[model samples]
Target: MSETESRPAPSQLRRLPWSEDGKSAYLSTGDGASFLARMADTMEEGMLTTAEVDMTRALSVADEVSASRAELKMAVRFLAHAVADAVEVARLRGERLGVDPEAKETAEFLRRTLTR
Candidate 1:
């Protein structure tokens, strides 16, 4: 007979029953995964908000006004590198865990601003 055939019915199953070993036998790995996903959304929303772009613009302006052309170019290059590194990290993390990375709203926002 199947292992389940000898067990009690669903209606008779004890809810949230811990084993005699003092362990909650039913783990919540799925809940942990869901929580992480939600945290990712919150982070993405905060990170790519319009405020970030505004801050970038303000920093760019400050850099342009305070630094030489070469210095400003170097600073911008550093900023681009930082952005690319973050994107790659996000992409790799999503790929490893079979989840989609955050949306590319920052790129779209920049594109729209540039074309205007």
Candidate 2:
């Protein structure tokens, strides 16, 4: 057999359930959850960094029309979405694991924040 025929087809490779793109695999529920948590944390950190940059620029320069404010606003929106996604994932996971009271409380808190 030729060298190409000896290898398995790409489609024959096993893929994780969470791997939508097929290029990467999460392997398990915990692994997917960990990835989501990390993404949320990174988004939050980015928001903080953007806010710090805006504040630093405001303090260092007298210009009131700096673009940093706009960047900070965008960062805040992204962080909000990230937080919402994380909370939703947690709520679903809690439901799957028998409805933890803390998860219900968290969902209520998120709802309150959204309404405000």
Candidate 3:
């Protein structure tokens, strides 16, 4: 819905964070060197890094037998959000690499295995 810096091409929409209005935002890095492109790249990287940290901490809290109910709830909530963000990030990256986003989602595979 919003352009980062310049007009994007016909295809190759880069998935960006949701807009303030709660709509999907996209960018076309015409040449992959636009100011917005760089910003988006940085933001995605930060998201992934932060998610990893949050997931790690959350998992630790979840595994603690002595953890309070409130502490466990907080951990599970953080983990759920981190996993959602990660799924989107992975899907976008997979598309950019010419891979089918649904080819074999790690999350889906995990769910299937866990269910069995």
Q: How many backbone clashes does candidate 3 have?
A: 0
In terms of TM-score, which candidate is stronger, 1 or 2? Answer: 1
Summing lDDT over every window of 10 consecutive residues in candidate 1, give the lowest-scoring window.
10-19
Colliding pairs, model 3? none
Candidate structures ordered by TM-score, highest first: 3, 1, 2
lDDT of 2 at 37: 54
Local distance difference test scores for all models = 0.51, 0.53, 0.78
Instruction: In angstroms, give how far residue 86 of model 1 lies from its true place.
Output: 0.4
Which candidate wins on lDDT? 3
lDDT value, residue 65 of candidate 1 = 62
| Top-down lDDT ranking | 3, 2, 1
TM-score per candidate, in order?
0.33, 0.32, 0.70
Candidates in order: C-alpha RMSD to true structure: 14.0, 11.1, 5.4
* Candidate 2 segments exceeding 4 Å error: 1-67, 100-116
Considering only N, C-alpha and C atoms within 3 Å, which residue pairs clash in candidate 2? none
Backbone clash count, each prediction separately: 0, 0, 0
